[model samples]
Target: MIDIKNVNKFYGQGDSSFHVLHDINLSISEGEFVSIMGQSGSGKSTLINIIGFLDDEFKGEYFYYNHPIHEYTRTQFSKLRNQNVGFVFQNFKLINTLTVADNVGLPLLYAGEKRKAIKEQVKDVLEAVGLPDASEKKPTNLSGGQQQRVSIARAIVTNPQFLIADEPTGALDSKTSREIMTLFKELNQKNKTTIIMVTHDEKVALQSERIIQILDGRILSDKKVNA
Candidate 1:
């Protein structure tokens, strides 16, 4: 449901300009699981930011389900992002002060959903993420894996069109990472949730249906996994 054509990103201006992405051309269908693999400063993050509607200061065309994303105004872009995309981060990004249910319900709360509905939706997502009993607990009391699960629950609670997972497994142990990947796969397969994940680990990338490797601000390779 995403299409990007001839996209280029730059920082600074004039003679001091630094190009971050080089003629990026990519398309991702609905429900596809794709991973972006890159080292530090390879511009993978920039590309995903554009895809996720988090960055609009770039040159090129982006079409989301045939809607020209580049033509949206700031308010429209922000609304579109809120309505369509969910994000998971390496650091879990949870608030220690809030209950797990409260954390998971933030997006719905921001969207003006009622507390009763938000509570039900939060419960469903927590159950889906294997954290059915975590609603009353604080994030600080959870293990890293449990915290990540809470983050995933928060992301999916909105029933967003797609998910942007930036280094979701970067802070976990190998076994925990595997469990998280398994949860992601279940979401993709059962819920038809499209996922665009950025990761540096090859093993993590391999778990996705497709892998796109970036090097020096350009796409190095795009290939499907054997499985």
Candidate 2:
């Protein structure tokens, strides 16, 4: 469902250049759960951002569901991003002022959905994330794991074809991280959504059907494993 070819990302200018990603070539099929593992400065997050259309300024080619992603205009990419990609960051990235439901509903609202539809969607998503009763509460009131669950709900509420999680369990305890991984497995198994996760933990990396080990901004190995 996604392909990235010869992608190179460089920051700064001229001799002051710092390369974040180098000649990345990868393809993720539909219904595949792939994990990206690397140490700090291995460019894992840079690859994620490029894949999710969050950063398209780098040199290379990107195709989404067989269409050339670079061909789309910025406005078109914004719409496609909201519709096709769901991002769950390590920080949870919840709105400080909004209730859990409000934060989860933000995507649909930005997509121009009606208020009633947004509310219903938020409720359904919250329930799916096992937080049916917590929607009305503020994120600050929730624990770290709970906040991460809220982030997951917000990501999956739109039923995106691709779920991009960057160190999804980075902030959670072991038990909660396992729970979230289980949730991700369930989503991939039952719904057939494609999952691309970046994690450094060995256990978390094992949760994926495939592992792509990156080193020095290059693919060291890509292998399939049992989830």
Q: Return model 2's CA RMSD, one decimal.
A: 1.0
TM-score of each: 0.97, 0.97
Q: All models: lDDT? A: 0.94, 0.91
Residue clash pairs of candidate 1: none
For model 2, what is the error of residue 138's alpha carbon versus the real structure, in angstroms, after optimal superposition? 0.3
Name the regions of candidate 2 deviating beyond 4 angstroms. none
lDDT of 1 by residue, 80-149 (tens): 8888999898999999999999999998988878888778889889999999999999999999999999
Summarize candidate 2's per-residue lDDT along 1-227 as a digit string, tens digits. 89888999998889999998889999999999999999989999999998998886888889887788867788887898899889999999999799999999888888889878688889888988899999889999999889999999999988898899999999989999999999999999998989999999988998789999999899999999863
Q: What TM-score would candidate 1 get against the native?
A: 0.97
Error of 2 at 194 (Å): 0.8
Instruction: List the lowest-lDDT window of 10 residues for candidate 2.
Output: 65-74
Per TM-score, the best of the predicted structures is 2
